[model samples]
Target: MGATPYSLVYGMDAVLPVELRIPSQRVMMEAGLPEFEWAQARYQELHMIDEKRLKVLYHVQRYQRLVEKAFKKKVRIRDVKKGDLVVKFDRAPVYDHRGKFRPNSLGPFIVNEVLFGKAVRLLDQNGETSTEPINLDQLKKYYA
Candidate 1:
């Protein structure tokens, strides 16, 4: 028979007995084969390695879908619109030298305009618009 694909490409078995025990090892040992013969038989099984890889891929994709569904369920769709009152997250609050008890957000700013993508332009209490657009994730709706 031809060499297994793994042995052809890597010049070694895809799995070594020391790393993972072969299920047939016990049966081969009971058959009174020498240690080297048992090892050779295990190498012959490596041709099925592609099937094992496919099964792992199927499990990984299923796990990823489950995680994605959980994440999407927890995510809130922001309904931010123009003229909405919102607070911006204070990204550099630690650098302000404020105490640890200080609030981690600033401004009940007004949404002056909704920009392209998940961004918005804001107007402070003074009604002056900021020059740059802010990401929607950085702003939370202000209640009061």
Candidate 2:
């Protein structure tokens, strides 16, 4: 009988949003289809111009870090002998990829003995010699 509240009523005749709305002038202007009388087509197209530029910049920065690490030779196998305190890589086995050979050092493993040219036998935390010899690069110097 009287004007129906929108929350309590709905039907094909419900033109509520268009009829019951009072939007700010700025909102209509930004949508560019304001009033359906005038169209500013360029208004919404400019939003991603800077967004794409930012994505490219971020990728470039990551590439630079990789390049620096490669050139500086930060990761390389070294020759470590017994009684030398060294830190192990400590990365988990889950991270090891096919060629990467993830050797996570536990406790900078004490170099109990150098078994062969490349393999250094280590005294693991359990006070037992590990069956596998660790590469020098997998061993980092241990510091307090």
Candidate 3:
């Protein structure tokens, strides 16, 4: 548009054929255009472009922060205590989701104490307690 408002190209740095540039530069010099005017025009144009770019960047950052906050929610894990009736996973079928779909839970076990790992001591509904510890993830707290 209107010769791109200004030409910041100096012939020395261009990869264009020398024949093409020499003739155009000679014409510009004859027209009395000063090199200083060309340099200043380039600097002003870049400043405007940079300012607009900064504003767009700032707006995008604010939107990202808002979305992150909206997606954020907290979950608190409750402590398992003694005499709590709980469900423990079956040993043979860790891959099955069918039990989770049904009421696949077994127990109403009483928690005796925590062992090493997520393992805990528990007493079954019939009063049998496991000697080996089990992970808490396999169990759910029984309300009734």
Candidate 4:
């Protein structure tokens, strides 16, 4: 997580603009070395680039798994079946205190078909069917 994008991709630390203006320790260290020796040292560093890339890959995969685990904790699994009655959720923001006028959800609609994973087709109370599929989150089981 502490890795910079340049380091992740290049397998080495970036030479900042500040370092160029005011010489850095690495530049100072390489200053006195012979040209052939410096070339040998650079080759060694390049040889280890693959190892650094592998380490970064491992870190990224671990982070992704942690995120997936945290996300799964808040998930609620909803299951519905054909012929089961369910109330469709109302998306409206309005709220009414009066019992007679307050209707937050629609129908006791019968489940007509269960579609691909979590989507369901519904038949309204008046025998009219909904053309579009509704997500499981928008439905709650109706009792009695």
Candidate 5:
């Protein structure tokens, strides 16, 4: 939720829990108010909570966009076209018969089709196309 837990639950910024044990300015101020007036104030705050929540939602979206832009600046954009050769990223390590370590990428799989710029369908070494498209992030261009 966009609103802070404290504000959502309390319909205002929550005073520190210690404020209840010790006396804080807010506690002391509210303490002097008659019970009926205090209840009325709380009811008013609750009625305006929707507007407060809207403000928080806008703030959260703005912050998220800022973070996204910062992240995109450091991203290495990869582009692939039909017929390009690429290697799939392997999640597990592979060992050769000679006990040598294998590279984390496998295959000079052929790019059979480029889909939506974000993913590509590949052709296996046998020239059969894979059923599912692989995300471009999981592939690197194959020079050979």
Candidate 6:
């Protein structure tokens, strides 16, 4: 374990010491080497730091993709199409005062258009199109 989280992730000691312990003389002697050799090794390690950080980033991205794949596999794809009847969920603002038993959703709106990326334009009973496209997640198939 390293003294700090940054040291643990990056595999380098921090510039500022949080705590210190004196090494035993015997341990120091065994680990000690010529100053020039130690400097060269330290320089090599410093040169490789960017590569190590890039590898960590790549692994994190790969892990995210795997998790996304697993999640997508379990999701039920909505089969909405143009002209389908669907109900939009009501997302009322907190300031709006409605009855406790008020319906939590609106519409049996007709699907006027199925746009790109799971969005739809809706039509009310009067055949007027909605002001904006709604996400498919906010709707479900409406059956009479």
Q: What is the TM-score of each candidate against the true structure?
A: 0.66, 0.36, 0.40, 0.65, 0.54, 0.60
Model 6, stretches more than 4 Å misplaced? 1-35, 47-51, 94-100
Candidates ranked by lDDT, best first? 1, 4, 5, 6, 3, 2
Tens-place lDDT digits, model 1, residues 21-59:
554766666568898987887776675677788899999
| Ten-residue stretch with the least lDDT total in model 3 | 4-13
For candidate 5, the lDDT comes to 0.83
Q: lDDT winner among the candidates?
A: 1
Per-residue lDDT over 42-130 for candidate 5, one digit per residue giving the tens place of the 0 to 100 score: 66666677788999999999999999999999999888888888999987645566444656788999999889859889999899989
Q: Poorest 10 consecutive residues of model 4 by lDDT?
A: 19-28
Of 5 and 6, the candidate ranking higher by TM-score: 6
Give the Å error, residue 102, model 3: 5.5
Q: Candidate 3, 77: how far from true, in Å? A: 1.2
Q: What are the RMSDs of all candidates, in order? A: 9.3, 12.6, 10.8, 10.1, 10.4, 9.4
**Model 2 ranges with Cα > 4 A deviation:** 1-77, 93-105
Clashes of each: 0, 4, 0, 0, 0, 0
What alpha-carbon RMSD in Å does predicted model 6 have with respect to the real structure? 9.4
Model 6's alpha-carbon lDDT is 0.79
User: Better model by lDDT, 2 or 5?
Assistant: 5
Q: Model 4 off-target regions past 4 Å?
A: 1-30, 93-103
lDDT of 4 by residue, 4-108 (tens): 999999998888796555454576465786666766766666667778889999999999999999999998778788999999988777656774567879999
Name the candidate, 3 or 6, with the larger TM-score value. Answer: 6
Model 6 pairs whose backbones collide: none
Model 2 C-alpha lDDT per residue in residues 1-144, reported as the tens digit of each score: 555566356532334363224333445555565565332333333345467778999999999998998988865557676876667676564644554654455585577987666667777656787787777766777766
Worst ten in a row by lDDT for model 5:
93-102
Model 3 lDDT per residue over 25-104, tens place:
44446557687765565567668779989999999999999888877644336468777778876656566666567556
